[model samples]
Target: MRQTNEEKINRLEELKETYDRFKEKPFQLNLKRGVPGKDQLALSEPMLNILTPEDLYQETEADFRNYGVLTGIPEAKQFFSEVLEITADEVIVGGNSSLQLMYTVLASKMFLGQSDKNSAWAKEKVVKFLCPSPGYDRHFNATEKLGFELIPIEMTSTGPDMDQVEILVANDASIKGIWCIPTYSNPTGVTYSNEVVDRLAKMKTLAQDFVIMWDNAYVVHHLKEKKEHVQNVLETSKSYGTEKRVWMFCSTSKITFPGAGVAALGACKENIDWVTEVLSDQTIGFDKVNQKRHVKFLKDKKHLLQHMEKHAELLKPKFDSISNLFGNYFGEESTMLEWTEPNGGYFVHLTTMDGCADRIVELLADIGVSLTEANASYPYGVNPRNNSIRLAPTSISVEEIEAAVKAICLCVEMVSLEKELDSNK
Candidate 1:
């Protein structure tokens, strides 16, 4: 028999009765992260073996061990540069973590300051950044830690609300930058449309030194048939004469080992030169040894595409399982629950009825399922809607995903039922 929304509500009430029985036990299961599962890790084992000491004990024509290539070896930079569709000179190869590179760039500006720019952020009376809502928490945290005021911008399926963004940038001289994840944005998985990207590229900011911190983390992590790729901001910026207005970032954290993979920064020559000036004071250079390994393993675009297919093979099942669960449990319902079916990337953004997220999250936690904090996606840990929740299906097994989704649906149902009851009262 097909269950109507009311019937589902009743069924959920019954499930809650069953859940109440187990409330006394301590609950623990983590579906809160977007890290790759163990199966995905196995795919990168070949790279490990390829980089062993025995494989290159003696330095070949290109030295792997020592250090000295501040801009990275030509071949390594060339290989990764292709991934961004930019030239080698426009890319700076960094050590394992892209997050580290992002932090370094921001910190350098906050402490050491940029060349041809003002002194450190400390000298400014107030510095502000445009934070797209329901964004990467770590990005927000980085700016907040440095005392920059974070102003939240609402996001649409196409992209951040550009009208408001332009207003903010055009009027606020203190608004120094905006953080963007153009492709497969963290929890939402919504790719920025070309129109949105173009508008951003052409914005006339009040601050001359304003920047768009573009974190293209999932540029190649597609789950379904390929969608249209957004134009490179580096290229788009140049077309609008805003070449120095963007700093693009990417990494192989998902492709290879997260902590041990190489990362890169793509920007205009002026921006790169400014970054290099401060970077000289920071460290000698990033890891060149891993750079050689990445270049050797992922030799060309063909190799990269083939390797990513392996990741897709492992990831698709997990996403499918969770999506199936959502459909099975809520397809017929007209309740205030909604979610995005993302084509790629690591998360599904879910929104419940207003003021119900915290309750639903608490219910799940009480029943042996853990989720990312309900408001962790929003700026300053406050979701204005109080309803958005991020679902990360990458780390757990398919079976665990099934179990977690079942528990999550029950919690959602309970919250919806309670809301319905309150309205009736």
Candidate 2:
């Protein structure tokens, strides 16, 4: 039964006392980013010792200590090919950050265009990129900085609202591209269904040079026994002869070392050639020594999966702790808040009742818990409803997570009661 107004007012007063008590305690806990825990990082420590002086040269007589493999070392390319499920020729292994590769590709398209077949996107009067909401903020920031009008697309359980995507792109010549984290997406943890993937591949766009930025950062980061697989964008696009329109990226940033991991891009042969040609002017090549090191450490896709299972073992408990606490505090029937229980991926997305998220975040901050800014998953850091909060439980200890979560639950109840009390008045 719902509480009477008088009871709610009394409860609010009691909660205010508890809030005052919390303020008296002093501690700092951060959930701002999805960084790997100490234990997770420790798992890859053996990688640093894998290389020796004798292993410095490849069988092809290429000196890894020197330079000259512009695309990538053959072994590195072969390893990424197995990881990306593409041929070695289709992959262009890059530096430690896949985000850098993505930025370069977009910048290239903006100024240079994909090929002579189309004009540069910068030449267009107004260029726009489709961003699926409850998505990655870094992606939105990138496009916005590059001067593209960031159009927000509604994200569903299966994927983006394709009906809207289909209609908008088909009618608007300015809608040039879409950003996708197709499998185990950043905050929401929703994977694109096969049908959604097929539609994206075959969709008719008004822009002849429309692009799809597929960042598969969590492809091997599985938290459950069953591994999630997304339909291959490059292979799917091949049927429609749209392979060049897809640029896929993956990295060992989370797999091994964020600072010195291997990153790669998978695209059509033509696009790979184009990127290779453009990159020749950027630098001699990425650090081949590190590339060779990763190849030695990871060895193959099978070994990569085995390594990721260790990550899952470390991460699964933290995710479970969040889920259990949320359920206990809010209950199955609560309408005040809802959160995702992702099978894989780094974040849990919590959505409070409409108009309450910002207040909750502010309350948490006052007591020294840092969350991703409210509605950060949306483009321009705005969610008109003001209800989304991305929770990152990876970096902190489970004990800290418990304390932080309990504090959050208290704040949720306090804010929710306050909302109802005001509504009744």
Candidate 3:
């Protein structure tokens, strides 16, 4: 039997009444994050076995414990360089998290200043960044922490609106940088098209030191039934003769353990030299032991691809489960709600009727379900539409996902119905 809106609404009311019965109790389930689940961690058990103390502890030419190479081990650099599609010298392997490296890059420019640019960002009258709307909040937070003004740009399925980006960058000398997630972007799971990448590469900015902070966090996490290719930003930069204008960042946080992963920054020689000089003032070098472990575990590109295939296998089912549930619950009433069926990455972006997201989230929380804050994807934690919500299906079990999705749909209906009823009254 097909469930009509009224039937769904009545069902939602019943669920709410039952949920209210337990509102005072503590109920906990965390679906508010995109962290990989336990099954994904199992794939890295081989890494633990690779580096026993008996195997290689001394600081030999081949051994990795004591610090000699500041950039990274030659083999590891060569391997990741291929992954990032840049020359070996252009890549610098840093500590566990890419977020830290990203902060260091910005902070270096703020306090120490870059070679091409003279004024430290802190001394500048107004330092502004072009932030794509509904972007990664942590990126916004990083710039905001440094007192940089964030200007929101709309993000399209293809990429950030290039015309607006080019206009702002070309005209404003204060627009020093932009944040981009080229492949499988954080909340929306959208990739930049070839033309978009090319345009970004060829952009004429007023600021000579204007940088494109490209964070390709989900480069290999494709969820499509067929294989999809992502354009190489570094290559595009070089082709457009704008190699120094782009800085590419990636990490093994999703591939290996998050806290104990290696991060890399790919850029032109000038940018690399500038960053290395500034970085030395802070620390002698990053951990080489973990870098060796990554190389040993993911021996080469072939090995890394094989490992990612395993992750895709585990992840595809979870994505399918949530998508199928959404379709079953809301497919017929498509006029009221909408969501993206992503091909890659760890999220499904959903949008509700205007001003209804906060209500839906609150209703879900009351029923022992948790979600990413309604406006978390936007600048200053404010979603102008107040409709977009990020769904992270990676951290929960299939069974839990089923319950959570069902609860979420009911909450959506409950909120929508209340709004509809209030308007009629």
Candidate of highest TM-score: 2
Off by over 4 Å in 3: 1-12, 21-27, 52-63
**C-alpha TM-score for every candidate:** 0.93, 0.98, 0.93
TM-score-best of 2 and 3: 2
Rank by lDDT, highest first: 2, 3, 1
**lDDT of candidate 1 over 1-425, digit per residue (tens):** 55566775677679778678657663556878888888888888887757766433454554556556676777777986888888889988888877877888888787776763466766789999999987999999999998899999998888899999999999988898999998989889889999899989999999887889999999889888774466778898898899887888999898888878889888888878877766776667777777878878888878888888888888888888877888888885646588878888999888899999988888888777888999788878897779988888888888888878877887887788777767756
Q: What does candidate 2 score on TM?
A: 0.98
lDDT of 1 at 263: 90
* RMSD of candidate 2 to true structure, Å: 1.2
Q: Which pairs, if any, clash in model 3? A: none
Q: Cα lDDT of all candidates, in order?
A: 0.83, 0.91, 0.83
Write candidate 2's Cα lDDT for 301-405 as tens digits.
999899999999999999999999999988999988999998899999998888898999899998888999999999999899998999998989899999999
Identify the runs in model 2 with alpha carbons over 4 angstroms from their true place. none
Question: Where does the lowest 10-residue lDDT sum fall in candidate 3?
Answer: 54-63
lDDT of 3 by residue, 45-71 (tens): 789778777444555565566655777
**Which model, 2 or 3, shows the larger lDDT?**
2
